[model samples]
Every structure is written in C-alpha cells, then in structure tokens.
Target: MVTKTEETQLNRLENQVDNGGGGAWEYLCMVRKLKVRRSVKVLKHGLLILNDSKKRSSLGPEEWTLYEQVAVAAMDCQSLEVAKLGGMRFFVLKLMQYVICNLLQDCANALQKKFPESKRVGRLEAMLLEAKGSWGEAEKAYSSLLEDNPFDQVVHKRRVALAKAQGNLTGAIDLLNKYLETFMADHDAWRELAEIYISLQMYKQAAFCYEELILSQPTVPLYHLAYADVLYTLGGIENLLTAKKYYSSTIDLTGGKNTRALFGICLCTSAIAQLSKGRNKEDKDSPDLQSLATAALEKEYKQRASDKLSVFTSGFKSLKVSS
Candidate 1:
C-alpha cells in the first residue's frame, strides 16, 4: 500500500519524466514497485529505453521486468483504444494499424517464448486475448490459469473485469460477491461492488455495502458520505434523520472541510424542516446546528470561491431553511 505522501512523490517524479526532465528508468522502476499504473506515460518512456540496446543491456536482469511492465502497459493502452473504437468491425481493422499495440504484443510473445513456463507471461497472453475481444478464448485461458493456482487474486479480478467489459454487470456482481465470500477483507472489491450498486440506483443494496465498509474501516469518511447519500436517496423522515447523522459524521471525520458533507448537512436540515413543519419547534432540527453549517459553508465559499458566494447564498435563501 503506497501511502498518500509516497504516491504524491511518485506523481511529481512522473511529471518530471513526462516533460523530458530525465529519470525514465528510475520512474518506471518506482511506479512498478508501487503497483501504480500510468500506462500511456510508461509506454512512451518505456519503449524509449527498450529500443535503446545499450541502456537496455545496462539493467541486465532488471531488463526483463521492464519488458513485462511495458508489455502490460501496452496491453492496457490497447484495451482503452479498443473500448474507444466500440464497433467490432472498426476495431478489428484499426487494431492491426495500432503500432504500439502490435509492438507490445511482440514484446509479450518474446517473453513467453523465452519463459514458456512463466505464469506471469501466461497471464499477459490471457490479458491480450481479453483486450482483443476473444471472450471465449480469454475465459478459457483465465480458467486454465486459475486451475493451476486458484488463489491468484489478479486473475480473479481480470475475470470480473471481463464480465464488466462485456456489459454483463450482473455477472460481474455475482462473481464479485462470490469472490468476497472467500476474501471478505478485500477493500477494493467491496468498494467496487458498492459503486456498481450505486450506479444501478440500487441504493438500498448500496447502503448495505457501505455499512459493511464502515464496519470494516470505521475511520474512512468516504464510506460515511456514501452511506449518507444512499440513505438520503431512500428518503423518509427516519432515513433523512439517519442520513443527516452520517453526513455530520462525514463532516467531522473530514475536519469539517468536506464541502459536499457541509452541503449535505444543510440539505438534510432543510428537508427535515419541511417534513416537520407545523410541529412544535422543539420537534424540529437544532437551529444552532443548521446555522453553524450555513455559516461554515458561507465562510468556505467566501475564502475559496468568492464569485460563487452570492450564488450559494441565493440558493440557500431559496430553500428558506427554517430558523
């Protein structure tokens, strides 16, 4: 797990490489170590080093790893290109004309030819089959790899990705759910499932996922915000009040600087005010809390978006939040 501070440093070094400020080999090695994917940039710079025989030889044992990284990045870029092409007929024709894609294919093939028994090389071939839209072949290839090592998490993820790419979201969800049953602690898979549920507007299911996430990692503000949003969308007096509490939790977790959470507080308070109208004043939201959220939001807009302050103020005024 790359810390935020380390990722920031990698990004800065990446920019230096992008601008021809040198450090291409160093940048590639660092990002590979961190399992970061800056594919396009890596492909551009990596090919430069790969094509230079002298520089390539200088790495000795490390050159093969470079080949693997570049090969993976190339396939990744090809997949993006294939996705953009969208039409099968156009993709078939354009893929042949895609020089970098072919170059990477050769790179991967060379490695596989040299190390026929290498599982890593085998996975690359499987990924290439996937990128080329050979769905049946890719599935068989992945399944073969899994038969050899059923615990390969990377291969499992690629299977889910294959389902997603084919627009079989339900299949992807099913695969993910099964995967999670075995690997419940996989944070990324849980987050991905939550996002997919939200995308389908299955807010109730999404809320359940977020609840699980919060239980597993209570300090994560993102889960609180997402859970709150889902509850708010489910909307009722009870859900709204519950959403407001999570929204407040999000704000507190983020040191009260999460603008979205701040706005969430205001929106929840206003909605509660509308619902509680004609009720006793004591039954409504705390006026102090409402005013404090509004004041903080106003201050934020003034400091960060002075020009938008009037818009923010007018928008809130139109809401006519109860005192």
Candidate 2:
C-alpha cells in the first residue's frame, strides 16, 4: 500500500538507523512494533554475505566476486525496510570482521578525519582488528589512543588485555602495576592482574596482587576466596591456614550458599589433612601431628558428606539445607 516516495523515505530512515544517526532507537522500536514481515531469503543471504566477508582474505578473487553478487542480490530486494535492515546488518558484521583482522588502520584513519566525533568507532575498529590476532596492530591503536588521550582508562585496560592475550605477561603486569600505582584503590585491576599472574604460574606475584585486592575490599567474598586459592597453590602450611581463614570468612559473608567458597574450603581442609598425613608418615610417633591430621580429615569428610544431598535440591529445600 506504500507509494514509491514513502518506500524511499523509509529506506533512508532505516539507513540512518543503521549508521547510528539520531532517533535510531525510537525508529527501531517503532519498526519492531509494526511487525512488518520481511523476505527470509533476503535476510539469510545478507547474513551469509556478512559471514563470508568476515574471512575476507581467505576468499579467492572468484569467491570474493561471488560474495559481491550475493550482496548485490540481497540489497536489491523488493521490500525497502528489509533491504535497509539487511544492508545495515551486513555493514556492521563486515566492520567487526575488518576490525578483528587488523585491517582497520585505513578505515580508522579515514573515519578519524571524516567523522571526528566518532573517534570511538575508529579506536574500536583498530582495537577489534588488533584483538583478532594482531598484537602489533592493537599496540599501535593503544599507543595512538594514549598519545591523544593519556588519561584513557579504557584504552589502558585494552592494552593490558591485548598484552596478556599476546602472551606478554610481563608487559601486562608492568602496565597493570603502573595503573594501580595511580589508581591505588582499583580492586578490579588488582584482581585482574592477580588472575593474569595465576595463569602464568607466577604464584608469588599473584599472591601479592591478591593481597592488594584484600586490602582494598576485604569484605568481598570472591576476593578472599581467590586470595585463599592462590595461597593454597603456593604450598605452605602457614599459607594454607591463611587460606582457610579467608575461605571461612567468605563462607560467613555469603551465608554459606556460595558453592565455590565451600569448594575452596573443602579443598583447603583436605590439603591440611594431606600435609599433616605426610608429616605423620615421616615421624609416626608424633601424636600431636596425628591428632591434627585426624581432625582435619574428619572435618573434610563431614563437610563432603553434608554436601552430597544438598547438590540436587533447590528453592526452599536448598535454602533450608544451606541455612
């Protein structure tokens, strides 16, 4: 029932929405509410084209030519709304792929000059490209962003993530360390750095980071649980006791339904038992060590036994058991 002019206007509106123009969200909501049916074939083919575009370099010239054919076909559909939606979707998909593949340098530079307000688009494009598999590209993007906006916490975080992803643990650690020096109260950064150190098997460094997190947010159950896990990993009775204390604190804070904290507590108790068992085996006549090992083993066994039936129950029953 729509006229040609109306269709053109609708198409233009859709394009505007796709490009993130003002009122896109309102228009999109209206379109969704309208429930206008679109050609499934057009939608499917557009998605296919977008998918093909993701592996752009993998496609031979002939394959690329075929993709162009599909894209054109998808764009030439009868429904103006469908065509507009499909085109916008295709652009975003391709853009994301280009960013992931580190092919966004040209696009970033072009967009920066042409659309300065969309600097995020350029930066995101470059970051995505770097994230896909090109640390070099990511580093360039971060360096450029840092030069332009030295106080960009987001860019700093991205650089740290990229560095860690690229197996540059030392670089990641150093950057995080510097960030923490300036943002001394950032528990999230400390936790992230601790996780990175744990991944790299740098237990001592991980422990230090965990200590920092605990200092900042001592009441956070996860922080205590994580610190305890790290301490347990480092393998010392003193540390094991410290880990148990943290795990207990976490359990108390979470009201004991935190299965992860419970698991850690169980593991720590078992560890203490194992350590005591080893010591007792070394000196069989040590009654004090034997008594401690037996107590730890019994406590671990009781906790596990209590947990067996609590696993399957849910809702009120689970709450009752947990309480």
Candidate 3:
C-alpha cells in the first residue's frame, strides 16, 4: 500500500524528473526508494528515455552504461511475478534470461567487428562471459587477451577474479603475486592479495602485505589497523608490543573513536602486563592469560556492545508497548 506521505513524496520526485532537471543518478535513487512495482515502471521509463536515439547522442557515455544496468533491473522485476509460483517453466525463463545476456555479448562483438583491436570491446566480452557464468570461456578470453598484450591491467584483474570465482585460491594468489612482481606499486592488487592471505589464516603473509601498504602510505589509518590486527592475532610478546604501538597510533589517528583500536590497546596492554610478571611465562598453554583475557573481554564489551544492546532493547520494548 502506498501511504499518503510516500505518494506525496513520489509526486514531487516524478515532477522533478519530468521537468528535465534531475540526472540519472537522482532518478535511480528515486526509483530505489519506491516499491519494486513502482521501480519497475520507473526503470522502464528510464530505458525508454535512454533508447531515444535522437536524444541519445546528447547524453554522456555514462548514460549509455546506466541504460544497460536499468534494463537488467527492469527485467528482473518484470520477470518475477510470472516465476513466483515456481515450476520447470521458471528454469526455462532463467535460461531465456541467460540468452538475453548472451545477446549483450553479441552486441559487444558487433561493436568490435569494426574496431577489431579495441581493448574496451575485448574487456566487455570477457566481462559478459563472466556475468553469464561462462567461467571457462571468460578465463580463456582473458588469457588470450593477456597473451596478446601482457601489460593489460584490466584483463589481468578479470583473470585473477575469475580464478577466485572458480574456487582456485592458490591460482589466484599465484597470479596476483606474479602480477605484483611486475607491478609492485599496484596498491589495489596488494590489498586484494592481502585479504586472500588473511582468509587462508596466513597472518604473516597478510602482515607483509600491510607492511608494504603502510610503507607506501603510512598515514592511512586502515592499513595501520590491518597491520596491528594481524600482528595481534599472531600473538607473541614482541608482536603484541608492536601491535600495541600500532593500535595506539590508530587510536591517535582516529581520535580514539575506533572501537577496534580501543579493544586492541586494552587486550595488548593486559597481555603484556601479565607476561611481564614471568609466572609460567614460557608456557604458551598457561591459564595465566585467562583472568586478564576475561577482564579485557568485559572491558571491550563495555566499550560499545552493552551500550548498543541497551539502546536496541529499549527501542524494542517501547515498540512492543506502543503496539
């Protein structure tokens, strides 16, 4: 049901669009704020405007790109009601959708036919293959493109992503490392490799990535946080000591607003203090860390968790009583 207030807001937004005042992004935002049924109509209208060939040339290249996205979202909504009851026909419909996606690949090829050596066309083809779940085909296409020009950053990134998508983490890591060997200054690739390493519990490898990242951009608080967290996880007195310093730096950088930094400082300080006492200090299995761990855990929770939980609970109770 469209509430009266929402209807009034929709009217104002639509008027803004019809007046040729709002841009594609603002219109897209308005569509998103609407119900899916309403959004479908809005998106359909957007495609209609985008497909207006006479006015199309007056639009920017980005408008053309946005048209493709609008078309996809519109089709998603338009197909839903027919498929909701669920049958073998739904599977058939999905296949039909895949066929439509393949048509985009055909269109890309048609564009490339005139400019046979166009990198953009080749990139589009590989991406379309990926989007349509033709992983092997996409991998081959990306590889062929890379073979043609080994320095194609876009193609290399797609190939690495394809490897990860195909559950070949090791292959992805190897490819990333090889890429980094040639392009060591590619911060984005370094960050991606570091995340993959962290997921695999390779804290030392992740730390190395953070070390590179910090060396490249020392003032980035996020890199410092990542480095501190990794060292903290791979606990040792020396690592914890270093972690605490980085954590303090993080707190300073963020003006003490980062809860993770706050937790890290508390936990590392307690651990270091307990270690300094030298009681069963050589034993990694000692229960001596337990008491401090408990206090550290409680202090961490008190810093943010309890406050947020109380607010949530109070809101819920108030809603219940009002209802």
Question: In terms of lDDT, which candidate is strongest?
Answer: 1
lDDT of 2 by residue, 155-207 (tens): 88888878876788899999999988877877779888888888889988988
Please report, in order, the local distance difference test score of every candidate based on alpha carbons. Answer: 0.86, 0.60, 0.70
Model 2 misplacement above 4 A? 1-114, 117-122, 131-134, 273-323
**How far out, in Å, is residue 40 in model 3?**
11
Give the per-residue Cα lDDT of candidate 1 at 2. 80
Model 3's alpha-carbon lDDT is 0.70
lDDT of 3 at 147: 86
Ranking by TM-score: 1, 3, 2
Candidate 3 or 1, higher lDDT: 1
lDDT of 3 at 100: 52
- Model 1 gets an lDDT of 0.86
TM-score, structure 3 vs. true: 0.67
RMSD of each: 3.4, 15.6, 10.0
Ordered by lDDT, highest first, the candidates read: 1, 3, 2
Clashing pairs in model 3, backbone N/Cα/C closer than 3 A:
none
Residue runs of model 1 more than 4 Å from their true location after superposition: 1-4, 80-97, 278-285
Residue 168's lDDT within candidate 1 is: 88
> What would the per-residue lDDT of candidate 3 be over residues 91-121, giving only the tens digit for each residue?
8767766655554644564556755887666
